[model samples]
Target: MAVPDPRGGPAPAARAGRPRIAIVGPTHPYKGGIAQHTTELAHRLARRGHDVWIESWSAQYPARLYPGQQRVDAPEMEPFPATGYPLSWWRPDGWVRLGRRLRRRADAVVVVVVTPIQAPAYLGILAGLGRAGRRAAGPAVLALCHNVLPHERRRLDEPLIRAVLRRAGAVLVHTDAEATRAAALTAAPVRVAAMAPHLWTAPSRRVHAADAPAAPDRAGEPAGQATGEATSALGGPRRRLLFFGLVRPYKGLDVLLRALAAGPPDVALTVAGEFWGGQEATQALVAELGLADRVELRPGYVDAADVPALFAAADALVLPYRAGTASQNVDLAHLHGLPVVATSVGTLPAAVSDGVDGLLVPPGDPAALAAALRRLYEPGVLTALAAKVRPPDTAGGWERYLDTLLEAIEGQRRVDHR
Candidate 1:
C-alpha cells in the first residue's frame, strides 16, 4: 500500500504560514549521538508549530554489515508509521520512490547525513526530488552533518562527502572545526549548528536508574557501592574517568588504556559503550598491562534511554580520539554539567575551554592523558570543573542555522524560477 501523504496539501491554519517541513533520518531506538540529535531536532522544530514530519529508517542497517548489535533499540514510545516507502541501502529504486513521496509531502526536507556509507542512498533520493520539477513546491534538502567525513583518516571520504553535500540545498555542521573541514568539501553555504546538549533534554539531579551504575557520591565514588574512593567531610565521589561511546580503533581506546597503565593505579576508568572492531585487542592490552581491574569495560550498544545513567555514573567524559572533528559526546557532557578530558585533535577545544570547562591533552600522548587524569582525580578538581560547565543554549537558538538553510533554499528557488 502506498503511504498517503499525512498532510493533505498546505492547510490555511499552519502558524505564520511557514512551510511544513519533513525531517528524514535515523530516529529513536538507534543508539548514538546522530539518532539523538535527529529526534531532538524534530521535537524542537515540531514545537515551533511548523508541521514537522519525521521520515525514519525502514531498515537502517543490514545485520551482516552492521557492527553494532542492532540498528536501533526496541522502540520505547509509539513508532512512527511506515510511509509505505522502504529503501534499500544498496538499491536506488526504493530511494527514488521515497524521494518522490517526500517531495509531495513536505515543503522542506531536513536530511541528517552521517557516514559516507549512506551517500548513494541520499544522492539517489536527491536526484529523484530534483526531477520532480524544479519550480514545483518540492521538499528542500538541508543536510545536518554530524561529521564532514569518516574519522579513520580516509582521503576519499572528503570527496565522497562533498559530492552528496553539494547536491543538498544547505549543509549544517556542529562546530567551527567541522565548518572548516566541510568548507573544503564544497562552496555550498554551511551553517554551524551546535549539537543538542545533554543525553536527554530535561536535566534532573535524580540519578537516572538503568542497568548501568547509579551516580557517584561526594567521595568521588559511585553511590550504593563500596571499595571506591570515600568522601572526607566534603561530599564527592571517588575520581571516576569515562571514555564513553562506541569503541573503535580511531577512537584511541588503546591509548587511553596505556594512559591508565601509566597513571595512578587508584584512579579507576570506565570504558563504556559497545566495541566495533578492536575489542579483543583492547581487552588483551588491559590484561597485559595488569590494569584489568582498574578499567571497567561495558561493551554493548547503550540505548539512548539508558545514556543518562552511564553519564551520571562517571565524573568526567574523556575522548582520546586519534582523528575527528567535534564530538557530540562533548556537547552531551556539558549539558549534563559534567566536565571533559580530551586530546587536542579535531574541534575538541572548540567545545571545551581548557582549565575552564575541562582539560585538553595532546592526541595520542599517554603521559599527557595520565597527567590530565591525575589532575582531574585530585581533590575538588571534578567539582570545580563541573561547576564551570554550563548547560548549552540550544532551544530557540538555531537562528544561524535557519538563516543559512533559508538562503540556500531560496537561492535554489530563484534558480528554478529562471
Candidate 2:
C-alpha cells in the first residue's frame, strides 16, 4: 500500500534494514580531482557494506564551454564496479526520470556540487525528487559540496547556489570555513568532513641526483651569475620544484614564475597539467622574466600512471593560489611523502602545518614565495618536514570520513522524522 501526501501522487515505499545509497557525481571516465574523489568514495562506501550506485553524466559539458582537451581520461587500470548511468547534462527530462528512479530505489542520495554551472540540471532533478517525496517519503539528499562558491564567480552564481542548496537535506563541506559559508546561504544542516589524500598507491621509482635536469642558461648573463644561490647550496645538480594541476588565473602561476626568477638560479621547476586560460600569456611571462631555461612546462592532462614519476622527481610541490576554500593537491603531496610550499589561504593553513609537513607564505607575494622556496634547501628543513608527512590513511583514513558522512545522513533522517 502507498501513502498519500498533500501533492496527491503515490508515496514512495519506506524500507527497513541497511540503507541503499546512490552517489550523483562525475566518476571514472571523467578526469580531474573531483572525479577521482567521487569514484574513491563510492568504492570505500561499498567496501563498508552499503549497496552503492553511481549516477554519472553522459555529457558533462559542451566543447565550447570546456577549455580542456578531453572530457574523459583513459579508464583507470584498477577499476571499481559501479552501475554508472550516462545521463545528459542538457536533458531536464532525463534528470527528472533519474530522480524518480532514485527516489524509488535508494534510501539516500549524495550529490557532489563543484561548480554553479550544473545547478540547472540539479534543480530539475531535485524538483522531481521533491514531488516524489510529497506523495511518499523519498530518499534523503546530501550535498557533498567540493566548493560552496567557485573560485571564479559570476552574477548568477549566488542565486543558483542558494536554489540548489535549498533542495538538499544536508550539506557536507571540507573545512569549517566552508561550513560557515554554506550555513549563511541556506538553512540546510552543514557537516565538516576533512578531505583525505586522493592517491591510493605510493610511487615505485626513487628519483636520484642523476635524474635531475640542468638549469637553463639565462640570456646575457655569465655562467657564474646564472648559477645564482642554488649552485652554492648544491654543487652537483639543480633541485626540482613542481607546480602542478590545471593552470588557472586564481592559481597564481605568474607569482610563482616571478618568485622563481628572483630566487636562487640553481633551482628548476616543472609546470604540469592542462592550461585553462591559454598558455600564451604564461609562456610570455616566463620569457619576460628570463625563466625560460629554468622552467619546464608540460601542457596537457597528466595520466594517472605517470603521476608517481612526476612526484618522485621533485623535492617539493608549490601551490601559490590567490584564493581557495580547500586544496586536494596538499593532500596529494602529503600522500606522496613530499613536502609542500603553499600559500596561506583557505584550508591550506590547516592542511600544511607551517614548518611541519610544509611551509606557508602570504598569497601573491613573490618575494615571500621565493624565500620559502630557498628555505627548502636549508640544512635539515626539507628532511624535517618530509619526516612529519603522513600517509592519508594514517592521518584521517577513509573509514573515518565515511563514518562522518553516515553520521550526517542519520542526523538528517532524525530531523525529517521529527
Candidate 3:
C-alpha cells in the first residue's frame, strides 16, 4: 500500500508510537565500511522496534571514479534483514521520486553524507522534501556525516557541503573531531555519536597450513635494537600484522611499509583490501627498504565470509592513516579479539585506548610505528592488550548509538514544529 505523504498539508496528528525512519546510503550489492555501517544501523534500529528501512544507492560511483571491484564475493554472511530501495546517485529526478516515496512512509530521513560529490543528489532530495517550499513540516532530515570534507579536498567541496548542511535539520558526526569540523562548516545543530564496531557477527578464524614457532623473546633489548637482534625469532613463519581496507595514499600504506622494513624481521605485514592506485610505488618502496620477504600485499575487495579468517589469522591490525576521521577497521579488529596498532590521527585516539586495547603512534612517523610493532611481539603484551579490548556493542553498545540518533531526529522534529 502507498503510504500517505506526511508533508502534503498541515502537520498531521502525531503517531502514538515509534517514528518511522528511512536511512539513505549504500547497502548490499555494495561493499565498503559505510555500506556495512548503514546496513548494521538499519537492522539495529528495526530490532529496537522503530519502523526502519534503508534507501541504498543504485549507482554509488562511476566506473572511472571507483578503483576497486565494486561487488562482494561471498553471500553467506549477509546480516541486514530490512528491505532496501536502490536509489540512483546520478539521477536528480530519481531523488525527487525516492524522496517523495520516503516522505510518505517515514517520519524522519537519515541521509549518509560521505563526500561533496553526493551533495547534488541530496540537495535535490531535500528540496523535494519542502526545504524550499511552504511545507516546512516535512520529514526531519538528518545528515549522518561520515566525513564533512574528503581528505583530498576539492575546490567546490566547501560550497557543496554548505549547500547540503543548510538543508539538513541536524548534522550527526561520528567523533568529536568530526563534530568540530562539521560545526565549522555550518550552523546546523551538530551532534556527536560514537562509531560502534562494524562487526554484526563474529568472524571465523582462518587456519594456516602449519603452526609456526613462537616469536623470540625481546626481554631486555632496547626499543631500537637492530634487525639482526630480532631476526631469529622472526625467521620462522613471521607473526602476521594486518593493514586492512582500501589502499589509498592518504591511508599511509607507504608509511606502514617503511615501518615494517625497520621493525623486527620475523613479523610479516598483510596488506589486505583493494588498492585504490598503482601498487608499483608501494612495491618499489618495499624492495628499496629490503622488506620484500616481510610484507604480503593482497589487493582485492575482501568478502564478508572471508573477513573472519583474515582477522583471526592476524595478531594485530595496523592503521597508519595520515588523516582520517574514524576507523571501522579498529572496530573489526577488536571484535575478533585482535589488538590494533593505529596512528594518533583524527578519531583513532578516541577509538583505540592507548595501552588498553591497542597502541597509538604518531602519524607518518615510521620509527614510532616500527617501535609499536616491535612492542607487540614483546612477551604477553599482545594477549594482555587483547584481554582488555571491549567490542563496541558491549561498551555502551548499539542501543546507546540508536538512542542518540533517535534523539537527534526528535530534536529536529521539535524544531520544525516550533
Candidate lDDT values, in order: 0.66, 0.74, 0.74
* Tens-digit lDDT track of model 3 for 96-164: 877776666678999999678888888877876776443464899999988888888889999999888
* lDDT of model number 3: 0.74
TM-score of predicted structure 3: 0.85
Residue by residue across 1-418, what tens digits does model 2's lDDT show? 1211312244344435446777888876777778767877877676666777688887887788787865544553234465565467778798887787777677788989968888888877787677323332577889999889988889999899888887899899988888998998888799998885555332133221112122221222222232334433434466778888899999999999999988877788889989997599999998899877778898998776677667766777899999988777876676566778999999899888899878999999999999988887776777777777764453255667888899888887776677
Model 2 residue pairs with clashes: 11-135, 11-136, 12-136
Q: How high is the lDDT of residue 152 in model 2? A: 83
TM-scores for all predictions:
0.81, 0.85, 0.85
TM-score computed on alpha carbons, candidate 2? 0.85
Local lDDT at 35 for model 1: 64
The segments of candidate 3 whose C-alpha lies over 4 angstroms from its true place after superposition are 1-15, 73-86, 133-135, 200-236
**Stretch of 10 with least lDDT, candidate 1:** 206-215
Q: How does model 1 fare in lDDT? A: 0.66
- Cα error, residue 381 of model 1, in Å, equals 2.6
